[model samples]
Target: MVFQFDDLKKKTILLFISAPLVGAGIGFSFMFFAIKNQPTLGETPWRTYLNIGASDESMLQKAIRTRVGIYALPKEEVIYFMASTDSDGELLTSDQRYEVSGIAPATKIWSITLYDKDFFLSDNALNRHHFNASSLNVEQGKPFSFVVSSTPEVGNWLPAPQKGNFALCYRFYLPPASAFPINESSLPKIKKL
Candidate 1:
C-alpha cells in the first residue's frame, strides 16, 4: 500500500500532542527520584554548619560551595548581620533556643528571620517570625541580639519548635556600598548560637 500525505499529517499531529505528555511523565518521574534520593545537608561538606574555622574572609567561599546564594548590595546599602542556627556548626533542637545579631549601618532598615530546614518561616500562633533591627533590643553601639529559646524571652524572642532541627536564614536588604562593599566581603558573618 502507498503511504498518503493525509496519514503522515495525522501521525505528525498525534506525535505533537503526545510528545508533551510523555515528556512531562518522564520529567516528573525524574524529579520524584531526585527528591527521594537527595542527600541530607550533613552528608556534604558544603551543607555542613558554618563557623567551623570560618571568618568573614572565608565565609563567602563556604556559601558558594554550598550553593547558598548571596546577592551584591547596592551603594549606600545598609547591612544587617546576625547569628543563628543557620549561622554555623550547631545542631538545633526544636525546643532549643538561638539568636542572630549584627550592626546595622546607621542608615537603613534591617531584619532577620528564622526558617526551618525547608527555608520557610516557622508557623507559630504568635505570628512573630522575624526581628528587625529597629524593633530589636540593642544595649550599646554593639550589634543587637535576638534570643531564640523554647520559651519566649523579653526582647526579640523567636520560639523554637519541639519536633525537628531548624535553620535560621538572615536577610540584609538595601545595603549601602560605602562601608559594606557590593562584593562578597560585604555579606555579614552569621555565627551559630
Candidate 2:
C-alpha cells in the first residue's frame, strides 16, 4: 500500500526536511569563506598559524591552507602572518586607500603579498601582486611605505581591486629566532588613508 499526504502536509514535510539543510549550508559557507578564529600569535589583524607544514598542523591551519592553497614551509624556516583587517581592526576593503609602512624583518628573504577576498591575486592593470625585499626600495635603517589602492599612486603602489575585501600575507624565509616573537611594531601597519 502507498501512503500519500495532503497538500498542506506535503508542504510542511518539505519545509521540515529542507530547513536544516539550508541552515547547514549557510553555516558551511561561512566556515569556508571567513574561517574565523581568535588571534593565536599576534595582535589585531595579524595571526600566525602554528605547526604549519608539520605532521601536527592545527585543524584551522589545515582548513586555511585548503581554502587559500598556501604552500608553507616549516615553522623554523618560514614565519608567516595573514592579516584581513587593519591596525584599527577594520576590514580591509578595496574601496579605500591604505598606507602600509614598516621596518623590514631581518631574514634571508621576506615578502608581503596581497590577495583578494577569494584568496587569489587581485587582477589589476598594474599586474603587481607582491613586493619582496629585493623588489622594494630598501635603504639602510629606514622604514618602507607603500600605497594600496585601485587608483595609481605616486610611489610603491600595490593595486587593489576596486570592490570587495583583501588580505595581506607577510612571510619571512629563514628568519632568525628573534623574528619568532614578532614585535607588533615590526609588522607592517595598515592604516586607511
Candidate 3:
C-alpha cells in the first residue's frame, strides 16, 4: 500500500489538536505538584512560615501565592508569619493546647488570626477569631503570650475549632522600616502544651 497526502494531512491535524491537550494536562499537573511541594522560607516538615519579598518575587512564588489566595501587602506595608504546627513538630489540632509567645515587632499594629485547614476562619464559640496588639494585655512593655485550644483560656486566648487541624496567620501592619528583612528569630514561638 502507498501512503497518501490525505493521510499526512489528517495526521497533522490530529497532532495539532492533541498536542495542546496533552501539554496542558502535563503542565497543569506539574503546576499542581509544584505548588503543593514548594517549601516556605522557615519550613520544617511540620511547620511553615511564608516569607514574601517586597518586589522581587519569582514567577513561581507569585503563582503559588495566587494559588493560595493570599493578597499580601507590599513588604514595606506589612509582614506575615504563618504556622500550622508547634515547636515539637506536630500538626496543630483542636484537641491539643498550644502557646505562642513573642514581642510584637515595632510595628504600628499586629494581629494573630486563626484559620481552619481550609484557610477559613475557624467557627469558634467565643465569636473571636483574632487578637490584635490593641486587644492584648501587655505587661510593662513586655512580650505577649497567647494560648490556642478548643477550651477557654484566660488572657489573650485564641480559640481553635472544635475539630480538625488549624493554622495561625500573624500580620504586622505599618511596620517600621527597621522591620524589614524579617526572619524566624523575629517571629513568635509556638509550643504545644
Which candidate number has the best lDDT? 2
Residue 101's C-alpha lDDT in candidate 1?
A: 50
Clashing pairs in 3: none
The 10-residue segment with the lowest total lDDT in model 1: 43-52
Models 1 onward score TM values of 0.48, 0.76, 0.78
lDDT per residue for candidate 3 within 1-193, as digits (tens), equals 8979999999999999999999989877877897556554464322232456536667766776766647766656666666777765578899999888887667647888889998899776789999877788553236988899899988778999989998888877877766656555667778888
Which digits, one per residue and each the tens of the lDDT, describe model 1 over residues 63-104?
A: 342443244342234232323334354566665555545555
Q: Residue 178's C-alpha lDDT in candidate 3?
A: 62
Alpha-carbon runs more than 4 Å astray in model 1: 1-88, 137-142, 179-193
Q: Positional deviation of 62 in candidate 2, in angstroms?
A: 3.0
lDDT of 1 at 50: 27
Rank order by lDDT, top first?
2, 3, 1
Best by TM-score: 3
User: How do the residues 96-178 of candidate 2 rate in per-residue lDDT, one tens digit apiece?
Assistant: 99898888777638888999998788888878998877778675245788888888999799998889999999887887777
